[model samples]
Target chain A: MRHLIDISDLTRDETNELIETASDIIVNPDNYTNKCSRKKIATLFYEPSTRTRLSFESAMLDLGGSVIGFSSAQYSSVSKGESVADTVRTVSCFADIIAIRHPKEGAALVAAMNSPVPVINAGDGGHNHPTQTLTDLLTIVREKGRLTDLTIGCCGDLKFGRTVHSLITAMARYSGVRFVLISPDELVIPEYLRNGVLKRENIPYVETRSLDESIAELDILYMTRVQKERFFNEADYVRLKDSYILTPDKLAHAKSDMRILHPLPRVNEISTAIDYDPRAAYFRQVRYGKFIRMALILKLLEEAEE
Target chain B: MIIGSIVNGIVIDHIPAGRGMELYKLMKLNELKCEIALIENAKSEKLGKKDILKIGEMLPFDYSILGYVDSRITINFIENGKRVRKEHPSMPEILSDIIKCKNPRCITTTEQELPHKFRLSDRESLSYRCVYCESKAQSN
Candidate 1:
């Protein structure tokens, strides 16, 4: 009964194995078309999400599995005051596996604790989104051709961006990886990540406010939106939302081969003008998301059988 | 300065000096109606000065809480005015309902029925993080 509650739950070997499986699925899609023909995936999203919810549905559909469950709390039994444990327990009776997304941190963990089937944390508030980390890893491997000895520049909301945090945790496992974390003073990386991962692992990293200053040395630039939902103060959200917009001017200083990545549904942090740039791989990152999820579903289902 | 010994009770010994009050408040000893003595800054050979707690009645005690507060704490069971057993409390791997998660986004905050759980993350620093949100537990 393994569950993907946090990025650290997957060892470095397991993460790499998932990346390889996702890559193989991309190259040979037909071979996996009926891997889960009779299986059903319960998509229990307690919050609003377009990309993640659809990615799970699309992944399940691509694997010949049926998708069930709600897109938001207002549409589900959760609105009727059903607890996450009860909802997951009920859903597990009808589904083969469960993929949960909740605004509250560790909600999926609660689901995992109660579920009989394997649980996948689609996204859990600003806490962890391990699938997004997998998507980013697959994208980096496909774009940069390697994961080691690279400088990753994470810009925008380093404080509450679960994607950035998960990516850092995943990347820190590889050798010779340094980080250039760019964010406003208000949105610096959390202390657990700074002290627990980077400092504790002896990984080299630099914190700065200027993305342009750090862009040139980066092999991969991971940008994130300053999520409004994470902020209790609307005034703080308004002030920090536009802290780092990736304009064409900013791209002029970056390495020619530097790849730009963002876990999508991005606001204006990335200018529309950079969409056509060869380095802009966020759209491709979204495509990689579906494949990685397909790989994850297959892996979990296979493990469930054994 | 003279705290009488109990005939049938428990004695918690070897708490670092000045931390007895903290342990008292944390254990909610004030809520108990039974006789209890908190001997603070008591002379000790091991700690030079230590805090000791004597409970006049044998109540269900969660020694895990004492271990989390201070691993050096020792518990002695007194029966018929004689020491029956001495137990050294060790740090528990998981702590449930001992401390509340302050992170507003944690699921335990909204689901009142959910037990507030924390996992011992770093033993060296005696750090525990909320199982729900991974926020560091605020030490009392």
Candidate 2:
């Protein structure tokens, strides 16, 4: 009964295998279309996310598996005070696997505790999101042709960006990978992650306020939105919101082959004009997300049989 | 004044007043076959208020149980109306099977088959953390 509650749960080989499987799925989508013909997937999204929910639904539908579950807490029995343990237990009786996304920090772990089937953590509150990490890994592999020997630049809201944290942790395992952390002083990466993962692993990284200066040296540019609600003071939020915006002019300094990535639902962090640029890989990354999810469903179901 | 202390018995002193009965309940002293006397609130210059428990036998007990509630207990081995040995509370080495980790994401908290394990990270601060999730506790 293996569960992916964190990114570290997968070893280096297992991670690569998943990426390879996703690539294979991308090449010949019609060949493995009926892998899970009679299987069922239950998506229990406690938080309202149109993008992630639709991605999971599309992935399951592509695999020929039926999808059934609620998209929000208000529509679920959770609004009537049902515990996560009880809800997962009940859902497991009908579905072969479950994907859960919740606002509480540890709600997915709680569901995994009581679920009879394997539980996949879609996303837990500002905590770890293993699948998004998988998507980012697939993107890096496809774009760069390798995962090592690259300078990855992560800009904006590093302090609260779970995607950035997960990507950094996963990339630290590879060789010759350096990091350029670009953000304002208030939203810089927290000391725990800096000291615990980066410093302890002896990974070379530099903190900078200028994104344009470091953009030319990067092989990957990962941009995240600077959210307003995360700030305690509105004035502080307004002051630093525009500091990390990526416009087409900013792309002039970047390398010709440098790939730009974002976990989308972009709010002016990367201008719409840059969407036409060949360097923007975020939309392609979304398609890769579905391919990898389809691969995941097949692998999990195969493992269940053995 | 529960007569003279018996030879080769354990004496617990300096417990906070009004908590003697609670300590007695915690230790289950009443179930023991040995004679026990629980002294009520007594005025002391150091503690200001204290209680004493005199047991008329060398009972098999671990003094570390007091590490959770309070650290003010003193144990003495009285022999022929004289203190032969004394022991004071020291910080425990490993805290387990006593308190559960509050982090619901912790492997120990989620896995039913796993045992709850924590290590004392800070001795002076009495801080403990779950070995799995790294959630901290002030005292346990």
**Count of clashes, each model:** 0, 0
Label model 1 with its docking quality class. high
Q: What is the TM-score of chain B alone in each candidate?
A: 0.88, 0.67
- How would you encode candidate 2's per-residue C-alpha lDDT over B88-129 as one tens digit per residue? 776566666556777654545434555566677666667666
lDDT of 1 at B123: 93
Estimate, for each residue in A1-306, the C-alpha lDDT of model 2 and write its tens digit.
767788888998889999999999889889787888888999999877876778888998998889999999899988887778888999999998889998765667778878878888888767778888899999999998999999999999998788999999999999999999999888899876898799999999999999978899999999998767556688988887887889989999999999999987798899999998999999998888888888777777787777
Against the correct fold, how does model 1 do in TM-score?
0.94
State the weakest 10-residue window (summed lDDT) of model 2 chain B: B104-113
- Alpha-carbon runs more than 4 Å astray in model 1: B14-34, B39-51, B84-87
**Per-residue lDDT over B1-140 for candidate 1, one digit per residue giving the tens place of the 0 to 100 score:** 66787999999999999989888887888998989999999999999999999988887867777888899999999999999999988888898888889888999877789998999999998999988888889864
What TM-score would every model get versus the actual structure?
0.94, 0.77
Best by lDDT: 1
For model 2, the local distance difference test gives: 0.83
TM-score of 2: 0.77
